[model samples]
Target: MIAALIALCVFALSGFGLSFWLRQKQDSSQPGEAATRGAEQLSQLRWRDFAKLVLQAMQGRGYRPVIEDGMPADGIPTDGSDILLERGGERALLSCKYGTGSIVSAQSLLGLSKSASLRGAENVIVVTPGKFDDEAERIAVPQHIELIDGSELWPEVRPYVARPQEPTPVPPTAASNIPLMAWGGAAVAGILVWFIVQGLQPDSEATSPALAPPAITAAPPASVPPAAATPATTKPVAPPAATFPSDPAVIEQHRRETANAISTLFGVDRALWSTQSTLMVYLSSEQSDPVNELCPLLERYPELASSRVQLQPPQGSTKAVRFKQCRTY
Candidate 1:
């Protein structure tokens, strides 16, 4: 009976050990299954959420990121560039495509390249949850578009993809402040020296002898009679009047000279011409408008008095500019 109890005890111990090994194997498999599900869920995220993830990843990579909500009305092509990344004056545009099992196409890359060119971006990137086709890769290679697929989107790759943060600039030390303090000390010393010199000056009244009062003397009793007043003289003289030329050639010359002077004063390149007794000024668009500066010119020149003036911008320019006579004068 004791031998039979020992056999039964050994059998029970062996069964318990087998059960423990099975449980350990099942637990180890659970982690792998969970990891696979997590990766699949990440790949199947919503488009907006995926864009948000891209933004977060870019931020972690030391890039200034902004998400564009809708298409911009500007002249740039709209290729669904949802994210803009900026760093050190360089700009990049990113388009995110999520939850799509198909490969990215070459047409998508072409559109992104065109948008980057129109928007003046230095870099273009397409973020996808799936792989890119062979044609897309060939097109992107030449266009300089970067493609990021789901496999590269893993957490371990983030650190490697992220740019290193720029070192913070060091502030000025106490030694740099020494010059300012020295200047202040020198100013104080100069004031003290001035006061000391003032205090050391000798007093004029203390150093000189005292003067005595002069003796009083009487004047003559008789005085000459007051001189007679002379008669007033009067004269009349005429004032000279200023003259101005009325000749059209002379007036046009004067206008050209005045316009040139005004142009030089205001740092504008302008040409003046006369047509049917009216003055026309052609100004290049590269220079600033001299409309306000023309007021003083009109006031000083009589040749342009009561004459119509026209200001024209460069050819092919759409700038609408109007010139009115100087009413202030």
Candidate 2:
């Protein structure tokens, strides 16, 4: 029994440790993904701002803004949208396309290269949060035009984008470890029972009923006289009344608190709120396991445990939202 209990404890501790470790690792990587998630926000910027971002990225590569006659000092054109960058006395024309929906075509690159050559630029650079076509890539090679697609553009502007700050994940509480611990304890108990049964078998086989010693008996002493009986009166007790909040304001507050608590628990940075008793949480499409970790923790707030949870997919995603609720009846 002792050995089994010890083994069960070890198993439970190991499982709990592994769960906490994994959560911490996931928390650590969230900061890196912060910029990627910020991509949605980045795509929403105005064209002018996007052009300025491209300018900054080019400047980081040792390019300086070449202010021309009747052009903005930032090298951004007031009449047109193209930017001009100069490095080592060589000029490059830059075009910034922000949306990720469309692809850059070969015809567009041909025109851009011709415009750059007319403007006395040595090279042309097209930066977009979208991909370029095969023909565009082929033309770009001969024209000395640099194509910066979504894959390359994100890294270039990641430093300039605003990333959400996620809170540090705290160690998993004992309550979170209950389910796994219960399973571990059950396994240990079963093994201990089997051991106990096996040990009893040998003892039972060696002992015989015929060789057992006779039982002994003892006489009772004289009884003393009973004291005078006393009577006492008691009043009936009533059970405590159950209190459930019915006010709209109070319920809404509880709902918000519950959502915030859950978000903090998982280190999610997005706003979490409840609608019609269903808590909504937003997460990246790649993250689905956190939903599993969420359901069990709902028990921490008994008043709000009845509310169902819905996970909203990341912005501009087509994936369906996931809904879950933990019930204790």
Best by lDDT: 2
Q: Residues 92-119, candidate 2, lDDT per residue (tens digit)?
A: 8887765435587755654565467667
Model 1: lDDT of residue 188: 53
lDDT, candidate 1, equals: 0.58
State the weakest 10-residue window (summed lDDT) of model 1: 161-170
Per-residue CA lDDT of model 1 for 1-329, tens digit only, reads 44344444544554455556554664566545544444454575566556666667766766676434563433122443446677777888877766446477754554565456556677787877667887567546545678887656545233433342222333467434544554545455555555655677777876666643455788877764555345556786778543557787887666665555444322244546566445566765636566666655555555465556677677776877556666422
Per-model TM against the reference? 0.34, 0.40
Top TM-score prediction, candidate number: 2
State residue 30's C-alpha deviation in candidate 1, in Å: 13
Over 4 Å off, model 1: 1-39, 66-81, 156-329
